[model samples]
Target: MGHRGFKSSQTQRGLAMVELVITLPLLLLLLFTFGEFGRMLFQYNSLMQASRDAGRFVAGQAWNATLGKVDLSATLQSQTKSVAVYGIPANPNGYPAVVPGLTTGNVSVAAVGTDHVQVSITYTFVPVIGSALPAFYGQSVPLGLALTSTVVMRAL
Candidate 1:
């Protein structure tokens, strides 16, 4: 009876090892998924804040008291795009974008309903693995996710 118990213990140890081996990959995948989700959320939050900042900046400057409306002048729109992309009114030399791959082209500023200014930012989120997955059976898989943030504030 004692001998049989020792044999079962050894088999149990082997079973545990096999179980770990089988589940390890799944566990790792789950962990990476969670980390990626957190990163995505963080990037989204940054975009939201940047849009808010740009909206605030534009709302304060876009109002034309004489015109009695929000002005979407070219200069004002350009500056708002700069603020959305670079956190500044001007895009300085050698200054990095607020978000990776973010560009002035991706930001748009417009007058909304004659009284409000709107700032919109669109960005693509690239995963840590890469922007696209390796082709499987000649079909390419894209992994980039698009995120957009828009804010409207009363022109000051």
Candidate 2:
């Protein structure tokens, strides 16, 4: 008589080890990519916050006729290590030697009236991980990530 009991062959089997081997690399790659993106986003946010702080400080100041040119850039440069004022011909690349992990670009400050001052901070963001993608040639990778921020405020 034929076997009347359930047969292992008839039951659906779980994923094979080979299947896991094939997908594990892809999963790990996706995880690493996501982590790198998160880090980049955090750095971008920090940069924006720094810019806002500097702009606000400048804007809240009382207008002084004795002050010829408000050196907001110098004030900001002293406040943080990652902030600097650009426009030095020696550093034409806009990379501020004083600031670490930040390259300062053009900064424009204009008096929008008698009681308002506009401050804009422009900077170049260099990705930590994306910049190294070129070393892994023949592998698919993302590179060349950059961002900028601007802030405006009113004088007190």
Using TM-score, give the best candidate's number: 1
Ten contiguous residues with the weakest lDDT in model 1: 1-10
Q: Hey, what RMSD does candidate 1 come out at?
A: 2.1
Expressed as tens digits, the lDDT of each residue in 15-50 for candidate 2 is 466788899999998998788788767766765676
lDDT of each: 0.90, 0.55
Estimated TM-score for each candidate: 0.89, 0.57
Task: Report the C-alpha lDDT of model 1 over 6-65, residue by residue, as the tens digit.
Answer: 565545767878999999999999999999999999989999999999999999998899
Clashing pairs in 2: none
Q: Could you tell me the TM-score of candidate 2?
A: 0.57
**Each prediction's RMSD to truth:** 2.1, 7.3
lDDT score at residue 11, model 2, on the 0-100 scale: 58
lDDT of 1 at 95: 83
Whole-model lDDT for model 1 versus the true structure?
Answer: 0.90
Q: List runs of model 1 lying over 4 Å from the truth.
A: 1-7
Superposed model 2: Cα runs more than 4 Å off = 1-15, 65-100, 103-115, 128-142
